[model samples]
Target: MPLSNNKSPAATDIYTISRLNREVRTVLEEVFPTVWVRGEISNLAKPASGHLYFSLKDSSAQVRCAMFKNRQSSLRFEPENGMQIVARANVGLYEGRGEYQLIIQSLEPAGAGALQLAFEALKQKLAAEGLFDEDHKKLFPLFPKNIGIITSATGAAVRDILSILKRRYPAANVIIYPTLVQGEGAGIEIANAIKRAERRKECDVFILARGGGSIEDLWAFNEEVVARTIFDITTPLVSGVGHEIDFTIADFVADQRAATPSAAAELISPDSAEVLIKLKHREEQLIRTQKQTLHNYQSRVELLSKRVPHPQQRLIELIQRTDEYSMRLKHQVEKQISNKKMAMTEIAGKINELNPAHKITQQIEKVNVLEIQFKKSITRSLEKAQDEVSSLSQLLNTVSPISTLERGYAIVTEPKTNKIVTNTKHLKSGDQLRIRLASSEIDSTVDSIHEK
Candidate 1:
């Protein structure tokens, strides 16, 4: 073959196959940088490096492609051979292998043939917004008073939820907020039912449920509208859609996710048998505790009763103490009586030793003699006092005013103050005076007075 569009080179112009392949690689690099190519994958290889090596082909032709670890890590789902894919890649040649290939940067499932792409797209979008995050999830209540159901009124999901709710907690009221479970308007209808249940205050919690179905059949529950409605509802939400392996948008947005409708009911309500068993066990424990406590108190009372003395024995001790006190008192009285008698006898002996009658006669004789002497002395004294008194009386009479008057002496008195005037200082000229005689006084005016 010619290297250029000329005749084959002789010796110097001919290049080896490797050199030719290198020329082809250089040309391909110049022709394409990165491009989009659609094909089905085959012979896929994933090694320890996490790089993907595969061949992309149509029925007519095939090309070698490689996705490095960085590009492979970006894929949301695992890729395999037979997966119809659209790859964005740079065209290049492997120098070592001397082969032409594409170095892939990214790949996606071809929409015209993809089955799970719609679901993946929705999942990615919702996940980006944290609708599927555990932090936003509400814990299922340990006890639910009423369970509101948003599902088809005639669907199997409703019957399953009701049966489980009744079996677990018969007291819980299960209200149905019926809605269309499938078809065009199903998402809006389900959202509306949730809102209505909240507005009506019909139930403490809600469950969005449906039986198993194809992904397309269950798409209503997976709609963003329904998921958002569950998130915004004030009542707690529990989602039970399809089977255990099935997941939906509503599951991410709900407060609780259950694999089946019956499981959702069981998650929200308490188990009847378990509760009853606990209650009965507690009751038995309480009764046993009360009986033991009563026995303890009764034993203490009986023990205290044994320690208490009898009333009759206590009375006997008190009576003995009283009798001893009485005997002591009687002895004290007799001793006092004997001591008094001895004292009286000693006084009588003293009286007898004193010769009372003879002494009394002597005392009487002395008193009589003293009385006679006193009378004689008193008589003589009386006679002498009488004589002296008569003489004194005569003397006093001589000094008396009446005697003085009888002797021709008169007492002069002042008429205003009734004072006797004996000296000239007591009398004033022109002062009225009275001359007191034995029986009468004559008034006079002090004309003159002489100094003593």
Candidate 2:
């Protein structure tokens, strides 16, 4: 393509496509400067280069736009197809394609600020992924040894946090990880500061804080990179961003959320005065217990002392009692011997009065006298017995069977039965018999029967 000189008919200026497009781009940029274009986004394309290419169209027509990587980095909300947006860009022509398009510098949703929508969108995303889950949250150390503050060193947030922490617990070690909390690339700097703190491993816990501001001023904390970093760190984190009502993605993802920077300090630091008071109370209790134990031991020692006896005194008392018992036992033995001696003497006197030799003499004399009397009586009794015997003999002679036998009568008896055979009827022939005639006896057998 050639550019013709309108003033000189014979003069001609030839141009290449690149040169022509360059001139057009310059002209459009110079004329348009920076303008706000409001329309519905369509055909949105985001490539790996981090640039956005889209068309902004209304009811009748549309314009092509290109947002470069540097400019796209400034976008808060993601541009989507069919979303109504207002882009602040400069009119320009694409040098390579020679296509007319707007060079977008900034973009926002039609109804809401870019930062707010971005904050809400990221908060929702991370929440859905359980980044803000209670299970993922870490508990703040009761007493953090080293506390890292990720904020601008000169910002009021650091000052407030330091003041409160020092006042509550002066022993706490505080470290400041200085970073930009607002403006361009603040999010990157903030996220990098967090990483550096993690790598250093210096702090027991982290306090991500900043002064109160609008959403835009507090935009770094709301960035996805910063939020994800807070969620991923092993160290416990407390987010104190903006005012009490203001909240960011960092707040949702951090382990604890404080209303302000001072509040975060209060939450992390323990009160030294209260702890000291409790320690003093415990010390007093221990002292009182030890005193009570000592008193009890002393009382036991006193009670035991009364029950123990003096060794020498107790031995002397036992020796005196033993002597008294020995004397009593000796006296009882002497008295028993004296009484026994008196009883023996009385028995000896009685024995002498009835002497055994004298009694024997008297008994012999009486025996002689009785012997004479016994002889005389014996003589009389002998005479009398003789007379009686004679009379009895005469009577026996008259009645005795032997006397009849002696008078020429015979007695017959069966030899086997020794029965008398008084009648001839009782005698049997051939039976053996004995016949007694006075002093003689005859043995015979019956030969004849006699009845008389």
Candidate 3:
């Protein structure tokens, strides 16, 4: 059945390598729009550009794959070599290499759901950073003035929150920052809403809430951005994302976590009826205290009235006492004047006795008599003294050393020491001696000394 090589050939289309690859890519993309492929990942390479290049393979075959940054950013868990994965991708050909490849639009871990894995991953991350720490959590406002709600405005969560708030505290004002609670990009929208509310500074507390839903529906609150935003804002936030059994990352990161949106409203809003009852009790206590205080004051007024005298009677008593005191004072004054007159006379007589003129006269007479007596006694004493002086002078001359000297008695003394030479034991040869005469002293040196 072999045909001859020389047979006339029919005209056919031809293509260059680039044109062939382009046509192949177009054909592959048109044939396989988007598909989910399951395989073990291998030779995974994540470049600085954030594009992931890898080979998805099974025991029998393999295929090349590339996930760009935009799609890879949405991946819940990191893709590693040998990790099983499911990739939603478009089949296409690389024009440069002319190789068939899968352009991944999304990726998920093979066994677990992507949203659940993402939630667990983010929870762990934020928990490790202490964002879910009790110390970082703020206390819910007891009586919030303005409550900011970051949730869908049209959802049942808002209606529940509003209804509970109205019933509990009509005074509280609600400001809604309408946000997406589910679906793509919902996390970013929720995070942005929190930031916007923060910048506006409208609420005393924030209730980031949503009604009960599946993990996918409530995934926005579990996002890292939303959790971090809730952590960063100054206002207290209450997270009420789902039913009692369900927990979101927002619940862990928020200031307070409520089981439901209605519960969150209850936590933030004060109970008006309970508050009124307390106020009423306080009012009763105040009234009772005031009445007791008024009674005490009235009792004191009555007691003071009994002790206080009538004005006219008090005035009459004062007037009568004044008259009696005036008469007694007048009588005392006259008696004092009479007594003073008598004392003045006595003092005058005593003063006259102490007068200087009378004293001077008596002193003059006494001085004249004493002068005469002194003169007579001085004359007698002078004569007696002269007589006694003559006798004493004769006696002195008899006992005086000068008299002894004049009588030829010689007195000797050591010249330098000026000591009398009473004992010859104290004198030594060659020592200078002084002979004391009546009129003069003679200096001499000792030639010999004899002890007697």
Candidate 4:
């Protein structure tokens, strides 16, 4: 069915052919401001003015398009009549020809656009199945002995990786498995190299590397074959496909992704210089500890040598000590004899002193002295106590509430709670209160209120 332009003749306005076409073009442009169109190029024409005029068409439909020189100049590949492309363009109408057309903003080969879509679809598919999950990824060997590198044989990527590995860690053995990083069979070659490396099982870690390029150039890393190969490998794989901003399916599937080939080498290898410095530090510490140990042993040996006295000297000291003891014994014996005579006289005196009458007299004298001292103490204590009591009584009477009332003041309290009534705000003229004077408490009602 075809749309008809039959407006009723009796309607107020009739459209001319040009006006009708203009109206249609406006409607078309408004309906589709911008769109993405995919088709093969046909009727392509370049009039030497640097502008491109072509018809984008599929088997069923075709639309005229014009790409300005500014836009065409930036295209990565030349446009040919039969080449399929995807274009981002604005819908427009050529008022002169009364034809609707596309004003192409940008376009790329269908292959590249399709690759982008495929990349996303495959990425999602792999992620959903947990192929890109961290749990599936292997841990990088802490100290890798052999490192396997899969990259182009003659590309700068391999050179950069080797240079970095050499600088960072010279001891690790490196194995290079050269393969095409891009082109038709690149993905398969890379995948096969990975499987081969795993079969060998010589390398502790593998690096899949490539230099920076357009997404199409680095598309091998985005291939499903390479991603799955990386995921299936037991040895840890690090993807270094391009610059930091570029990411590929291999990056997610690999154990880790480095921003560049150099970064991948640095990531897996320990710095030889730093390791050497650490070892030197440890050696210095061991030397210091050994030196301290030897010094302690030497000091101990010196002290023992001083403490171990010669046999002759030890004997001399023992003889001197015996002579001193002999002299002390003689003096002690003489002293004992004298002491015995004196003790005889003293015992005779003590026997007389043990007489009961004499002892009773001495005890009576002691009792008399103690009795006098006790009487004095008691009298002094009583006097001190009497003085304290008199002072406290005076102090108490001076500050007593009764004393305060006797000085012509009264304490007023609310009879309801027996609380002091210092504020009149809570009282009314007829409220009951108790007024306590010096000697009596009187019940009263609040009189006519007053305030100062």
C-alpha RMSD for every candidate: 49.9, 52.1, 41.8, 35.6
lDDT of 3 by residue, 1-452 (tens): 34477775443544678888998899999999998888999999988998999999999999999999888666757788999887789999988998999999988877545565667787888888899888987777666667899999899999999999777776667899998889899999999999999999888899888998766677777778888888899999998889997899889988888999999988887776665455346434543543454345334322322332334444344334433433443344345334534543443344322332243344346534544554354345334433433444433322211123454768899867766787778777899889988678899998987665
lDDT of 4 by residue, 242-330 (tens): 99988999999999999999999999987755654553464345435434543453343223223333344443443343334334433
Q: Candidate 1's residue-wise lDDT over 1-452, tens digit each?
A: 52677656788667788887888888998899778899999999988988889999999999999989877665755788799887779999987888789999878778622434566687799889887787877666555566788899999999988888766676666789889988899989988888889899877788889999866678888777887787777778889999998888888888888999888888887775565455346434543543454345334432332333334444333334333433443344345334534543443444323333333344346534643553354345335434433443432322211122454768888877776677677557898888988668798887887775
Q: Tell me the spans in candidate 4 whose CA falls farther than 4 Å from its real position.
A: 1-36, 39-108, 292-452
TM-score of each: 0.49, 0.46, 0.45, 0.49
lDDT of each: 0.69, 0.72, 0.72, 0.74
Candidate 3, which segments miss by more than 4 Å at Cα?
Answer: 1-114, 309-452
Evaluate residue 278 in candidate 3 and report its C-alpha lDDT on the 0 to 100 scale. 58
Model 3, clash count? 0
Model 2: per-residue Cα lDDT at residue 44: 89
- Residue 83 lDDT, candidate 1, scale 0-100: 90
Q: List the residue pairs that clash in candidate 1.
A: none
Deviating ranges (above 4 Å) for candidate 1: 1-128, 133-135, 312-452
